[model samples]
Target: MSVDMYLGPSKTQGSTTTTVCDNYGNGLNSLQDAVGNFTADQVLRSLAYDSAKGYFKEAYVPLIQGAILVVEATAKAVAKLPSDYVSEVDSCDLKSSELEREIQRYETQIQGMQNQINQVKQLLPVSSERAQHLREANGLISDYTSAKAKLEKQLQKLLAFHAFSTMIFTEVTSLKSAVNQGLAQVSGGKGFNANKGTFSNANLNDRSWMDTIGKKWQDREKERLKDQMPNMDGLEYKQIDFNGGKVWCWVKKGRTTADPEDIEKSFLFNDWVARMLEKYGPDYFKTDREKGVTDLLVEQNLRLFEEVRTGIDSKTGKKLTPAERLARGASLVNSLAALGVGAKQITNVGKGKAGQTPKKPPIVGSGRKVPAIGKPKKTISAPGKKIQSVKGKPSKVKAPVKGTGKIYNANGNPDLRALRRPQFDEVLKNGFPDGTKLNQHAYNSLFKSGRKDIMIDDIIDALNSKPISAKPGSVEYINPKTNTSVFVNPTTKEIVGIWPASFKK
Candidate 1:
């Protein structure tokens, strides 16, 4: 008789269910039943002596011996039965019982042999390496399992959080939509209108009311948005002085019509005048006053005229004014005089005067002695008729001295030559010395007089006591003859002027 232990209340608490005490016993019985079904001869036939037989034999011998002992013990136990058990027993039954013992023994031997075959297979070549690989594979499997578990846990958590967040977002979106709809309804389907009112509203009735309160806010917002947007206001054509001084014209706000006269009037209007005063201050008006106003008006008109003229010409492809013809007569005479072309020569040319005709000299008294009119000539005879033809080489002709062409050589001023080399290297390094004042007209006069040999720098220095006031590159040397100015590049020392330097004499 085998004893079985029952744990208290095997059914889980609070769960109404029956627990099976024989479940583990049934599993063991099933294993035994399968083993018992095999025939002893069949189990023995399955095992053959091979390389695997050594391990099988080792195990099988002891197992067979133990099974034999068990069988004998069982037989002895059965033999103790009363005479009634013998009456029920048959001879075939005894044989079958014995055969079952043999089957069990054979099956034990076969199982041992199978274990030995597995062992032998493990002992094959590189078995240790294979074992190690299997172990590593097991370790990787463990790692993957752990990682999968962690990932699954994280995924679960994320799914939960997503559900929660989605719920919250849905709620918030619904709330916002509802609130917005409510606001729209309250504000007459236009949303919350902060500054909405009728044109005739009491607040808007006074123009100064908005000017007083909303101006600053509107200005700030405008500035903020202006910063955000690119200013694509087109090419703002501002009327500027030729020298880029004060602005002559500007597009007036709310003025769509571009009439030249109207534009001028806009510039001269009170608002513009007030703005100008504010920008330039009272002194600008006081000092300039009439001249400033006149200049502003003139420039405005000129700029408007130029704009209109350019637009018209572009459209028509024609000039509005005729070619300005040069007047002859006194104007020509005056121009020649201005050019320093002698007035008398021009007068003569104007009158068509011709040079006087050449006259023949008077003949002396015919074959008679006549007194010489002026000093008597002393006649010298040709050097005593040498009569000798010298047959030597001819004398060499001496070369004539070249003319120095009107250059003034200072009498005893050797220091003047030193001036050619730079003096006060730092002070006059850029140009002439400081405090130099140029005779404004000299540059044109010198060039006109054909004094080409005079260096421009020297002429500038000569005219000024100190340095030239002009920046190095700013010195515009104008040749009156050509009516063109030479623009000297300071860095490259490049002189760019009109073509044909001769024309610029």
Candidate 2:
């Protein structure tokens, strides 16, 4: 059996022996016709058919391919007509989307920056607090160091006092022992009376008695040395209160209290010696010859003083060669004497003149007037006017009058004949003169019209048609409507009244 075939939107049944009729030709013709009426759907469907045929390797593929070819050719023709029209529409949509993304990104970035700034701002007070704490800690350390230094100085003073007290006690003990030994040697050879009456005779020179008296003196000295010993019995060496505390020590033949002043004097002397050794050398205190010590220094000082006096004397010397030392001494004495004398004279004068006031000088030439310094002389211009002068005063003169000696109206307008006609004509032709008046009518008209295009000639012609009778320098013009005098520029034709046309009169 035979059958017909159809494709696309129209379908037909066909015989088994004959394959589907190649309707792709009609499809291509339809595509070609549709190309003239190419809608987007037709183009998509044609492209799909070409893609299907290329995939299937069918014999009728040429028909589908031809459709693609026709569509592509038509598309190329459409493309040639300004691609920007399509691209511009697409680009505008793309730009809008891109702008939205950019704005969002910008806002996000701004928010992030603001967050970071806020975080940094929050840390400022904390950082400032830490810095203040650090400063306070540093100040505390400084105070501690100062207190430590002061304590060290106090400890050194205490150590010095302890050493001094110990030394004084040792010296007193040694003196007491020496006194005891001397008494024992004298007492070994003889025996003497132990009576207190033996001390009453000043000339009694018995050796035994002297030995007895010396033994007793030595005993008393030993007791005094013992009493003067430092009161270190119950205290540790470091804890001993040597400063301002009384120390009992044994001295020659008796117990006594050691003088705090004497002990302090010893310490002060020692300190002075030590300081002298440190500063000047150890040999500084070996001699008592002050004259020898001061001689060179005195000579040096004298030489220096002499040099200074010589310079002063040389600068101040008048006639004779100045004796440096003598001149300075004489000057000092004279200055002192002058001060005394001048003070006394001033006190004695006491609001009274020391000398008589000088009399006024007599006037010469009947006290005739002469001009004072820098004073301009006054002049009188009138022929019969007399120049007057008072005694001892300058003669007066009059000032010359300014101008052509002719008075004009207060407005500075000249007479009609005085106006320069040639200058006036030039000004009239060239618009307003350098200084000219404007009339009310022309002023109002020109300003209201705002007509800058009108040339100087136009103004001059307008005014020349009717010569206005007005004073020279007076602004005059013909009224545009009335053809009468209107106080515009007679010389130059510019509107010459008040400015700002809105202002009247």
Candidate 3:
């Protein structure tokens, strides 16, 4: 065989291969695979078998030297990093006495970086020392690479500081050239920011550090825009201040119309948002109060936040304004009173569990003025149907009665309010899908010819009684007499707000 060529224990070497062995490469592969899959103890046992010539130890001699060299190289690189204040104090000409504040700031930053690198080191497992040579080599390489990359990104910042330091006390021309060279080494593209007084457009591969702040800002914007639009309605635009000196030109709800003023404002706001994204690069939201590409591409923050609304009736497909809600509330109130239910009990219902706490009803006399609720001049009581009051006081039958059925116990007594609960449950089971705003017409239609007030509180209490899969915001109930269904808002215990079973809008 020639000195440069090898002869192996095979008769034939075929195709692309120039050499072959009798055991072939398979023996080496199987041995290496064994090293990976064999129990650590098994490997230890095998390694423990003594060779009279100390053959296993001899085999690792070169590997041990290589490990020593690699560890030395990593240690030298780590040492090159300014992990100590002695280096910082020595590198800068800052006197020990000249306003110690600046020196402390630099020292603190150096210490922080060192601490971060140490934290990364501490993450290595305690068992790593058992694999000391290989583990040390890998751990040192990973930690050193991480620390170096982190520090490299800030080199320009450090250079600027150096330049500033020397600008007052020494020449900065060489310092600027050194910075350009450093930038060239650290990041290949873009350099020399005169405005920022540092390098620009370098090392931007991972810029997600700002996402946390951006998400936080987005949530704040969503909450503000949804909180009743702050005395404005329809489409409009407003410039709001973002934290940390950032600014937002937000499209919001205001007086929306196709008037010249409104058109011009809309056009200008759209133009401004477009120009900002084009000029400043990608952002998360297109406009504060509207949907856009920002919603499509991001996670963590909500994509869109719709304006706050009073909501629409599910049955009639009509918007429920505050006045309408109040009217419906009053009607439900009348029904509850006729069934001898109280407002306080209705408001305090559903406080049994942590998440099931009920919201208080919009109380009358709690600020908003409501018409005095005296005798309805009309009652759910049938005409000419005189009955004894709960206190056993005889009362005259009221004229112009409202409801359509006997809303009392089988004994013909209103005081057995528990008897009324079954009827309420019956209404809950049969009358509504959920959030159904029952009025005189709907209530009257619920019966054949008599009047019975379905107390709004009774409706709320009944609705809460039905079982629902998942934590539902509402439940459905049916009116068996009319075979009509309605939906009720569980949170408000109101007969409106949720979209009704019969209505799509």
Query: Residues 1-505, candidate 2, lDDT per residue (tens digit)?
Result: 1111111111111121012122333455575454334332334455444433332221122223333333322222222211221221111111222223333443443344344334334443456543543343334334333433433333333234324423323322433344344335334322222452111222223334334434544564564443232332222111011223211111222323334443333333223322332332212323222323222222222322333333333334533222222222222222112212211111111111011111211000111121121221342222443231111222222111112312254577543222222222333343341233444454334433333223232333234334445666655444332233435544554455422222332
For model 2 the local lDDT of residue 432 reads 41
Residues 1-505, model 1: lDDT tens digits: 1111111111121011101212322443454454444322243432222312332222222223222222222222222221111222211112222223333443443344344334433543456644543443334334333433433333343233323322322322433333333333223323222453211122222233223223433553464443231221321222222211112223434443334543344323323223332332222232222333333322223322332324323335554321100011112222222223222322111111111111211111111111111111232122342111112212221111112212234673333223322221211233322122223233333333343333333322122211122455544444332333444444443332212245555
For each of the candidates, give the backbone clash count. 5, 43, 31
RMSD of each: 59.0, 65.7, 39.0
Candidate 3 versus the native: TM-score?
0.15
Q: Between which residue pairs do clashes occur in model 1?
A: 40-103, 433-467, 434-467, 436-466, 436-467
Q: Residue 29 lDDT in model 3?
A: 44
* lDDT at residue 245 of model 2 (Cα atoms): 24
What TM-score would each prediction reach against the true structure?
A: 0.14, 0.15, 0.15
User: Which residues of candidate 2, in runs, are more than 4 Å off?
Assistant: 1-126, 186-505
lDDT of 3: 0.30
Error of 2 at 429 (Å): 99
